[model samples]
Target: MPTPTEIRLKRAERLLEVAFDDGSRFRLPAEYLRVESPSAEVQGHGPGQKVLVSGRREVGILRLEPVGHYAIRIAFDDLHDSGIYSWDYLHRLGTEQAERWAAYEQALAEKGLSRDPPRRRGG
Candidate 1:
């Protein structure tokens, strides 16, 4: 597996820049990470049960906790802190970002969902 060499948290840009030992790097966005979380809350218990998470265009990463020597548990500002992102998974996410993002957008459109949260009634 291609292990991560470094992870730069660009909080202002809401991005996580991860570099793997194989010379591949990915700038994963906070919203993408939150929606593609490996946690059961997002991935579900089995296949064909993946949930379509929306209204997270502004979510941010609160912190990242290392889990053993394999993965890291991400703590999102949305209070979701269960997904354990491994080196392999993160690499795949980075590589498949374009296709996955396209699918996500299509799913959202089919479900009448929006990436941005609902607007507040009051000022």
Candidate 2:
């Protein structure tokens, strides 16, 4: 069980860099994190209640507000600041990003949604 030693938000790059004590670092995109937020507004109270977040394809982090030493609250450009991202949760996200992303994609496919807008093909 590795623990996060530091978490830094690169607002300019729209990424969150999390470094663990075990010398591993992960850079998570703001849009991905926003869509995968654990807040009730997004995740709801239990399984099968996740709200598909749209219009966040261009969303970015405006700022990172530290909540003491336990967590960091991310303020997004889309005005979603309700979720408090904890260090442990962030670490878990970093570790499970691949699986979580795949799951999100599957869910989106089932619902006929996409992370980004469809591109127009040449005639």
Candidate 3:
């Protein structure tokens, strides 16, 4: 796995900038990360059991913690902290961002959902 040489969280831009040892750099949006979280809660128990996470267009990373030597635990602003993203998974998310994002959008559309959650009228 290509280890990250640099990792920066651009709070204002809601982006996580990661530069790998292989000279590859990725600027991943917080919303994308939130929706594509690798947690069992999101990814499910096995293949084809994946859940489509919607209403995450405005989600952001609240913090990140190292998990031993293999992955990082991401705490999202929405209180989701189960996903431990490994180097390999992060790399794949970056490299295949376009395709993944497109599929997400399609899934949401098919389910009559949107990136933004429906707002409650009274609370």
Sort all candidates by lDDT, best to worst. Answer: 1, 3, 2
Q: How close is candidate 3 to the true structure, as a TM-score?
A: 0.96
Best by TM-score: 1
Query: Candidate 1's residue-wise lDDT over 1-123, tens digit each?
Result: 999999888889998999999999999999999999999999999998899999999999999889999989999998999999998999999999999999999999999999998898988
Q: Give candidate 3 misplaced runs (Cα > 4 Å).
A: none
Weakest lDDT window of 10 consecutive positions for candidate 3: 114-123
Supply every candidate's count of residue pairs whose N, Cα or C atoms clash at under 3 angstroms: 0, 0, 0
Q: Which candidate is the best by lDDT?
A: 1
lDDT of 3 by residue, 1-123 (tens): 899888899888988999999999999999999888999999999998888988888888899999988789889899999999899999999999999999999999999999996688987
Which has the higher TM-score value, candidate number 2 or candidate number 3? 3
Error of 3 at 15 (Å): 1.2
Q: What lDDT is reached at residue 8 by model 3?
A: 93
Model 2 Cα lDDT, one tens digit per residue, 1-123: 666787777877889999988888999999889998878899899988989885567789988888887778888888899888877888889889999888878888888887774666998
TM-score of each: 0.97, 0.85, 0.96
Kindly indicate the candidate among 1 and 2 with the higher lDDT: 1
